[model samples]
Target: MNIADVDTPAVLIDLDRVEANLKRTQDYADAHGVRLRPHIKTHKLPRFAKRQIELGAIGITVQKLGEAEVMADAGIADIFLPYNILGASKLARLQALNERVTIRVTADSAETVAGLSEAFAGAEKPLEVLVECDTGMGRCGVQSPQAAVELAKVIAGSPGLSFAGLMTYPAAGKYAEAARWLAEGKRLLEEAGLPAKIISNGGTPDLWHAHEAEVATEHRPGTYIYMDRYQVEKGVATLDDCALTVIATVVSRPTETRAVIDAGSKALTSDTLGLTGFGHVLGYPGAVITSLSEEHGTIDLSASDKKPKIGEKLRIVPNHCCVVSNLFDVVNLTQGEAVVETVPVAARGRVD
Candidate 1:
């Protein structure tokens, strides 16, 4: 089917651009001797995950068990579940998944560590655990390198848990500091007779700066597959590198300065994240997405001389691609203006 024939408010992935982005990111990681584990949370489609792995990604990083399961079930052998695993049921599932593939998870607490170790005691292979350091993200990791070392020591001594390495999600611009902290943690661990082999750090904003830091041996960049408004706003990627967009039909032109499209909060998401609005229009450079409802996206098109007529299609690049992807069960794959195929967002809404 032609792209124009497809339904409005549909997510489209440009095949050529996506392949180029995958190659660029993968080549950069290979050149620097750092393993690239492109996070599948951004795209969620198994076909894209296979493409990334074929492009030289060491493995894939998943935020939750469901994402991991989707990838694993699709024949992805090496998987990393970066989030801390808790609860008896989740641990049991992780242990079961370990029997089929190489599964690794993060930990920041002794109680959680003990729980995982106890749960996976009889597994065929030890559950690989990485000490999660906060590194200024202030989110889910432990605060200090000393604390990370302590956790590593505990994991080393645990029966079913093995200290795989140190992991972190560094805050933007904190790459150098995070690298230092991770390096320190590794040194302390080695000195204490516990060696850390995998020092993993993840963040799309800090991808370029990953090599500058010494200890980061692997990177987990999810959003690079579909560069969005946030990455463009932060200058992480240029407009040319953006591969995904919401194709919306201009359904309303009530005023001379504003036009409304059929994509909105449910389509683009409400993640401004210091940006001006929900998304940005490609051809209409200066126009801003002023307002968004569940089924409508309002754009201020007064600055441009050309106006979108009723039924005209326009592509809207979302601010946060990850969240926007989760809202849809499938996305249309296209080449230029031609529709290639429709791929399901296999891991969408798989929060578990």
Candidate 2:
């Protein structure tokens, strides 16, 4: 079926671009001698994850246990969850998942390690735990190199946990700082006779410069598979590099300078990521997605002389592709301008 025949407010992925993105990033990782563990958060499809693995990805990174479970059920043997997994109920799920796949988790504190220890205790194989370092992201991670070493020690000493190494989601443009932080942590670990097996650091913005980290043995980049407007704005990817777009039909042309599309926050996502507009209108280059309601996307066509009329369709490159993927239950897999198949988002709403 042609993409044009699909209903409005549909998610579309270009197969060619997806293949290109995968090959390019995997080749980059190969050339640098670093393991590419592409995160499945961007495209929650097992098919894509398998494709990534086929293209040379050592494993797939998932943010939640639910996503890991879905991938594991799909025959993905190696999986990594880079978030702190807590609670007895969630640990029970994690334990079950660990039995099914080679699961590795990230922890930033002794408390989290203690919890993981109890969950994987007396298991056939100890769960690998990576000490999350706060290189510069200021998110969920240990504050300093010393804290990272301390946590690594805790993991190494834990009965059911094996210390994997250091992992960090560094802030954009902070690769050097992140490298130094990880290197120091590795040094302290060595001095203390603890092995730092994997130093993983990643972000699409710093993907190309991943090798510069010098200490990272693996890189996890999610959005590189489906470049978006934010990645384009960050100069990490170009417009032609974007593989995913929201196909919306112009439902109203209230004025020459104002138009509305069927896509809204529900479809086009509300995250601007400090961008000027909601998304980049493909055909209408000058149009700005001014606002988004539940079911409508308001576009300001004041900058363009040629505005979209009622019933016209426009493909939009969203600001953040990962969040957009979570909002849809299915995505149209297209080859060029034709919709080849509609694949269910296997890990949608797997937040828990």
Instruction: Compare the candidates by TM-score and give the number of the best one.
Output: 2
Separately for all candidates shown, the number of backbone clashes (residues 3 or more apart, or on different chains) is 0, 0
lDDT of 1 by residue, 1-352 (tens): 9888989889999899899888888888888887888898899988888989998888899999988888999999999998779898898789879999899999999998989989977776999999889998899888898899888888888988789999998887777888888888988888988888899986788887767876887899999999998999899898888899999999999999989999989999988988888888989887789989999999998787888899999988889999989998889999988998998889999979
> Candidate 1: misplaced stretches above 4 Å?
none
**Candidate 1 accuracy as TM-score:** 0.98
lDDT of 2 by residue, 1-352 (tens): 9988989899999999999999999888889887889999999999999999999999999999989999999999999899898999999998898888998999998889999998888888899999898888889999998888888888988999999998999987788988999899999989988869998888788889988888889999999999999999999999999999999999999887999999999998999999998999997888999999999999999888788879988999999999999999999999987899999999999979
Worst 10-residue lDDT window for candidate 2 reads 145-154
Clashing pairs in 2: none
Reference-based lDDT, each prediction: 0.89, 0.92
TM-score (all chains, Cα) for each model: 0.98, 0.98
Q: What is the lDDT of candidate 2?
A: 0.92
